[model samples]
Target: MSIISLSSGVQNNLSIMPRWPATQVLIDSLAWQKLQAVQASLPGHLGLILTRAYEPRVSELGRARTAFRRAGICLFGLLYRHRKEEIQDIFGSNGHDLDGTHIDVSFSINGQRVRLLPLSVFTPMSWQARRIKKFDEELSMVLAALLAQGFQLHRNATESLQIHCDLKPVL
Candidate 1:
């Protein structure tokens, strides 16, 4: 399935991207565990989706890089956690396990931050409602981070970030 097929709202929100250096993160295992714990502690569908539908924490990020390439956006992937080879070997085994991004540092090149693709590219197709909600949370966090860093992203009604943007090297 394609990014556009995930959610209409995602498309609307990501249609316009703010000009900023796109940074994709590889969330540590602890973060995943923490999210899992949080879900477990909850008492309803929120916890159910997180506990049931969530994919295993990934190590190698080749698939994410591929998504970034497919979106044609320049994103710097950051990983803070080191895992076992077995875990890395299983990376990208499940397509639903996309969106391991977490912002670590924000920097600009030549005093100008480049434009980022829409946040939707990181999200994967899923039928669960709560899972989709989590994707929105990730996307919002990215948008908020960009805005906080003095970048501006607005929706482009005539174009989509996934099909239109070309990533430039941040260097």
Candidate 2:
């Protein structure tokens, strides 16, 4: 099983606390499309493992899991977020809890495990513009990187692109 790690950095200017605008088309369609594309490209049987942690709403987690299942993928592990005070309740060290250093999602394909870094921003206003741009850039980079590694894209009009390769694991 081959393991791949994709790392990305967020702009320091981008606020973690987002105040999304109401009329941000960039956040709504393009960002969502990019996210969907990335999620869809993930191989089935891998987990949506979390690297950097965050307080994801239960609904959002459920939706993500549902989307994975619907796409014939398996949900595996999670990385939980903790505040400074809550750090002791989870991990013992502040250094270990640093943001954007871990996987936000993980999965196994063809017996190989992969982790998705949690660099994609999620916020209400991100539904408007900023998040969408980030999403597009990130997804594009992911696609290009995968292609560079010899992964080929398979188009499926009935659904998302179905990746095909001899190494692809059986779901």
Off by over 4 Å in 1: 1-27, 48-71, 74-171
- Candidate 2 local lDDT, residue 98: 26
RMSD of each candidate relative to the true structure: 18.3, 18.3
lDDT of 1: 0.28
What's the CA error at residue 74 for candidate 1, in Å? 10
Give one digit per residue, the lDDT tens place, for model 2 in 87-124.
23222221112221111222234434321222211112
**Each model's TM-score?**
0.22, 0.21
C-alpha lDDT of residue 43 in model 2: 47
The local distance difference test score of each candidate is 0.28, 0.27
For every model shown, the clashing-pair count is 2, 17
lDDT of 2: 0.27
Candidate 1 residue lDDT tens string, 18-137: 212222222333333333343334333221111111122343444454454434432212221222222222222222244322211211223232222223333222322343354554
